[model samples]
Target: MKKGSLLFVFILLLSSIAASIGFAQEIGKDKLFVAALGDSITFGYNLQEDKTKPSSQAFPYLINEGNAEVANISFPGWTSSQLLGALSNQETLLALQQADVITLNIGSNDYLQAIGLQELIENQTPIEFTPELQQKIAAASAQLSQNLQNILQTIRQNNQTAPVVFYNMYNPFGASEDPFLLSLHQAGEQITLTVNQQVLNPIAAASGSLLVDTYSAFSGNQAAFIIPGDIHPNAAGHQVLGALADQALASLVPAAPTVEIVFSTTEKTEGPVKVTVTADQDVLEMKWLPGEQTADKFSAAGNVINGNTFDVPENGTYTVYVKTQEQLEAVKTFKIENIVSKEEEEPPAEEEPPVEEPPAEEPPAQEEPPKEEEPAEEQPVTEQPQEETPVNETEKEERTSVKEESTTPVVTVKKNELPDTATAAYNYTAAGAVMIMIGAGTMLFRRRRARVN
Candidate 1:
């Protein structure tokens, strides 16, 4: 084979081995652990298919990717303070410690309950911006600030390296569209904006984590995202939220992590040598490389796992590689001795040289009368076959044409209930992340956590 073809095959072989190892790892592993802390959004409130199972379209299940196990400690009507209180719960803290990713959304309920915005929304009365209410909102904002920092601190204490995702609040109050309610809507929106900027942003900055702008993701798109007659996001909105979480997980996944390769037997005396390579540390994937590839390019793409076994076909050097979700790569090389087969081991028997002999005198040929073949001159006739090649070919073509005509159209397109944001980059831009305020028609705590998407 050409060198390029050999390289391609080498890559493919490694990928296959990597896939097998990864498959085995996946089968052997427990599902990826993910934890979320927040309010009703995290709890998956009204969008229930039943009491026991949460909505499949809810952000966590939507982001499940079939391999993640989520510990959603959030509950309905949970304010930031309530989330802080729940952090003391053993089950919740354990989940955080074991989580590969965590998401948090809080403070919205705190703001809403404090400002009594839900009461105002229900009553259809103009909010007087009462002095006492302003003090409460300001106090709520302070609590939100402190609670957010504390939440992040607690998460770090559990899983210091797992990425944490928190989103800004969305505005759910029906705004200026209603002339009589302009002031109320405007005031609520202003408060939502305040929480996103003043409360969430600084905390995210301090924690060195992501602050997804749910406000941006849901703003103006409420008709598609919010529940009818309620402030919480609808099932569709959950997808958007999930997509944001997915993006954070995708981006944070470290490049293929470095691995240490191990071999069961580094040297071989015959064909079919089995060498097992391994990484000492935790890894998401692993690969086996043939002599043709450089270790540098082994991690360009494809899933791999902790250990892989290879059947060496020839006497040559082979490299084993390991990769982790953290983007590290480890390599080790081992050589197999020139292979010796049993058949080739024995010596050949000796043979004597043959004696030379003089050429024999030309034997007198018996004279035979020359028979002249005059077929062309005599116009010899030839028999035609029963079927002509052209005729048979034409019949075959006709049959093929008939078969083609009888074939039915195949279905190739499919509709997905979920959004395809797998390739969508997170829109961190303020212009792109339009805030959609959502609450109990009053406040929104949009904290969410981060992992294994």
Candidate 2:
């Protein structure tokens, strides 16, 4: 595919997604939404700057200024049945659901269509309340009553608290000079009174809707309220209706009661919890119930639970309801599961004594000076006599044995005395052996001399 075609397709896909996900402009949540439903009287038929659009001078638009949003659902020539049918449309249903207030000016077309008033007026025929016309009006009146009931019911199904302005029809031909028109005006006035008193008034009262007295307000002022030669209201007429609608709505809707619930604890724990409730107005009564409940569903009775503090038992969710003296009610709900007991309720056992450590030994004492004491006695010893005769032999044997064992003998020599010999003969014998050796050598020498001679 070409790039241009592909781009166009992508754009179309994005547009479709945006539409599907709701790019439609939204009414501000803070602004009051007023849904206006009726015939051309509420639509501002000839008063529109652009004929295709709803009029800026319409009663719905004049009802409020910057703080409100208006959805003018009225169209040209919409009868009670048509309006009732329109309530099923998506746009109308949405408007009803969002409306904080609604203004209704229907049933005029129902009367006109049934009686063929336009045909009579176009042919310049004189007006007469004939049996056929009376039959048609009566039938229309019955239909209007049923249709009005259904319309209010539908509005409440979508929005429970929005105030409705039920407008009764007016006689627009009262100021006409033409005989036929005057006759038509007189008959219309009677029919208008009958319809308003019998059909609209009772229904509006039963539905708790505000009934705007348009018939009385526009009684003889049709020239000022209605456009010249036209049954639709002029800008001035719409303005007057707007002021009346505003007044009726203010009275119809009571001030919203302010109420609050304060729980002792929002958490789960063991034991009962305390709840306190407060309101800006005088509280007639209050009640406690299991789980959450709306004001309509609050069926608790037999006990007036209103007070400073109420104890809620453990392990469940509960809703508390407060009804003011004005009959308006408010509800608050909370969840809790109390299971654990408080510590102070059960005291702990006494603790054991701590273990003791052994004592340490004392360090050694420093040494002190010695004290004098008596000496121990020694024992006596006995002496033996010495043998003198074998002294030399013993000494000679000792010397020989010592010499046999070892040649050198270790002797202790005192400082003042020489080392004594073991025997005197030992020294004498060593001298004799040395002298005999000398004699033998001299004799041997002499014998050799003689042999030579």
- Judged by lDDT, which candidate is best? 2
Summarize candidate 2's per-residue lDDT along 201-276 as a digit string, tens digits: 8766656677899999999998889899889899999899998887775554445567677778766667687878
Model 2 local distance difference test score: 0.74
TM-scores, all candidates, are: 0.52, 0.51
Best model number under TM-score: 1
- How does residue 17 of candidate 1 score in lDDT? 38
Question: In model 1, which runs have C-alpha deviations exceeding 4 angstroms?
Answer: 1-30, 49-54, 64-66, 128-130, 174-176, 255-453
* Candidate 2 to truth, TM: 0.51
How many residue pairs of model 2 clash at the backbone?
2
Q: Looking at candidate 2, what is the lDDT of residue 331?
A: 76
**Model 1 Cα lDDT, one tens digit per residue, 286-332:** 66666645567774743243336667677777666665554455666
- Prediction 1 TM-score vs. true: 0.52
